[model samples]
Target: MLVALLLLVLALSNEVRVNGERGGRQCGANPSLKPRPHSVSILEFGAVGDGKTLNTLAFQNAIFYLKSFADKGGAQLYVPPGTWLTQSFNLTSHLTLFLEKGAVIIGSQDSHHWDVVDPLPSYGRGLEVPGGRYQSLINGYKLQDVVITGNNGTIDGMGLTWWESFRSHSLNYSRPHLVEFVASNDVVVSNLTFLNAPAYNIHPVYCSNVHIHNISIFAPPESPYTVGIVPDSSDNVCIEDCTIATGYDAIALKSGWDEYGIAYGRPTENVHIRRVHLQASYGSTLAFGSDMSGGISNVVVEDAHLYNSKGGIEFRTTRGRGGYMKEIIISDVEMKNIDTAISATGYCGSHPDDKFDPNALPLLDHFILQDMIGTNITIAGSFAGLQESPFTNICLSNITLSVNYASSTTWNCSNVFGFSDSVFPKPCSDLDNPSNYSSSYLSMLSMKGKTMVSGSVSMKK
Candidate 1:
């Protein structure tokens, strides 16, 4: 069963209620749902909700017609109870795509059905391949005031064929995401269930004011590279009350990749993630880059439950990745049956291209992880900062992880500096000294650019 259905089985109302508005948790900007002045049903556009019918033309025609209402208080396109098969479609600004109860939007299984689009500016090339990538099932570009909500309607990506092709190396382009929003603002994706995404489910890139609340995301335990929610190169984001289980990172924050991301110079910041139950069979519950060339900072993640996962939280990047990840706080987290509770490594990713400067080094600083409790953890943490550019000001407080390490060190450290207090299992002696922070800061300030740097739990089981 999808975790979203099991976790959200109790709340069956057809209303938008953010945790903040309900008067319990105040973690994100409150974005309300105002009813659209004009509403149209998909049925009127000749869209048959039968699972076998392909309604690609119907969606495109409907959106084209709805674009005229952009100035007329926007509009709503209601999808009633049925499985609507689509190839790919674009969304208009100031529009609401509401899926009613038992409504489903399934992606076409044929790879050729998806549109081929150019790669993102920050990525320079396709994520998995060198050529252009396929467009997401639902795409929005340079729009505003878009909302994708429903009474827990499901968006199913029949991704088995895509995954099979990827594994066989027969794919020509990178797989398409389930839904993607690019360079948009005031976006809201709530009260929905996303399943079996080909790659990522709900990817908001180069966007702002994105609110993703009260949603469920699930992929099979064996699915490959199926991430839940990825907020890339965007800011002012809120993700709460979500239950996600996948093969990869439940929630991954990324900016750009290698020199391409460095050239883009856009960082992902001002994000709030809370009250999320995340699980990953082959990746971290929450991750930050392996492609963070555009920087990721000022992120707050709290009140999360990470259980039965391979890794809890990880920060991943490598040399030739010129970016910074700092000013982050992760608190009030509980972890169970995790392989690695926390980890940050400098040598953990591949470069996008050979043109990337081998000297571009990343900066990791000012990270605080506290108020965390874990049980049945194999490794507490493993911090491997770069020798040339060491990670600094890492503060760990009020953290307790029950780990049974027979001979290996509970916490592995290499060229990393931090301070630890009120932590069980006895962290490395390097973290005991807060005095090293000054030297590391001075070292970073004195150095210039272009320096040479050296670098889940299965749910079914």
Candidate 2:
């Protein structure tokens, strides 16, 4: 077990190195978007961009007409500078939807105009409600080579009404997202500004080779459950060079939910997030799971600036969540004015139903946090792991968190163990005992009733 775990860590290290060395601003050399063979303007299909007319059918017909070019190198649908108000529109495969500067596609405020869809197989229900969800403004499913790029174009989900309804508990279904892509591959969304989403700004679920870059996503700080980017049950996702400020989690990496998620049995893995600025007024700047019964692993987050967050980095799971979160590395992070710099709790989120396995324990291990610095933090760290499955092999190196001296407790820990190297304000004794991990790779293991990091991997200061 030890050898296998070490090999996984080393292999992850090598993968990170390769990804970091890739040239150009693209995600793994994301091919430069070339011009499509055929192009059409929305006006060609008699779509008015007055921001008042419901152009839902105009947009649909335009895409239907473009379906002819699917086999002939695909096509492009260009939306010139104007406010194009519409409901939800599904994108076709091998298509590029480009928006010129000052172009805005607005989601209609009429809730009845939106389409309702069945809940995800993993969740078994809508995320906030117990039934179907309003479809996203722009959606792509089972697609290949789809790009939604623009010259800083905008997709606005005027969600104030939705937010009010949600707060009043007056909604019959879950709110909609600004953009979502499900079960899709080779998708790219860049150079856009997303605002006032009913829920999430951008969501990619059950997808692969998804790249989201050079985008700004935001919602009102008072908006409830407004996430910025959610990568759920998705693999090979690259989210970088983005700025996101949301009412809730800036980025939540999830797999599945409880029994339904476990039944799906597909883990979200091999993800990379870098070079981003994130702010969450009421949630974590970055988070992993509360509904991750399908498992999440092999993620790397580096060169990030997290500021003004309720929590900086958090790992949330409940008793009934049967999954694992492991082989993750967070490095080169700078935090400011954070309520909690780091937290890992086995208590958060709700269950889909009562058919969850109470004995299904979630594993949390091999999390390496290195080269982190924080200032004006209320609490330094809190590690609350499960007694049945205590978190282990959490290696912290060169972490300096400037916490409030007036606060009674800077760090709180229980049922967790690891090696802490040069952490400021000192972590709890459960993990403060540091070994020279600078020259050794580590794996998940605890022997003789003592939890610690043990292996042979090199880390630089």
Question: For candidate 2, lDDT tens digit of each residue in 1-461?
Answer: 43444354445445454545464322444456788899999999888889998989988999999988989988999999999999899999989999999999999998999999999999999988898988999999898888999899999999899999999999989999998999988888889999999999999999877888899999888999899999999887778899999999999999999999999988887677889999999999999998888898877787899999899999999898999998778878999999999999998888887889999889997787877999999999999999999988787767899887757899999999887657888899887654423224353311200111111111100
Cα deviation in Å at residue 266, candidate 2?
1.4
The per-prediction CA RMSD against the true structure, in angstroms, equals 9.9, 6.0
- For each candidate, what is the lDDT? 0.83, 0.84
TM-score, cand. 1 vs. native: 0.89
- Model 2: which residue pairs collide? 440-457, 441-456, 441-457
> Any idea what lDDT model 2 has?
0.84
Candidate 1 per-residue C-alpha lDDT over 1-461 given as tens digits, one digit per residue, 9 for 90 to 100: 22232122112111112222333222433466888888999899899988999999998888888888989878998999999999999999989999998999999999889989999999999999997999999999999899999999999999999999889999999999999999998888989999999999999999987889999999998889999999999987789899999988999999999999999999997777889999999999999998899999867677899998889999998899999998676777999999999999999988777899989999998776777999999999989999998888777777899996643678999888877767888789877675544444323321210010000000000
Error of 1 at 333 (Å): 0.2
Q: Which stretches of candidate 1 lie over 4 Å from their true place?
A: 1-26, 405-407, 437-461
Model 2's TM-score against the true structure: 0.91
Instruction: State the displacement of the C-alpha of residue 200, model 2, in Å, after optimal TM-score superposition.
Output: 0.8
lDDT of 1: 0.83
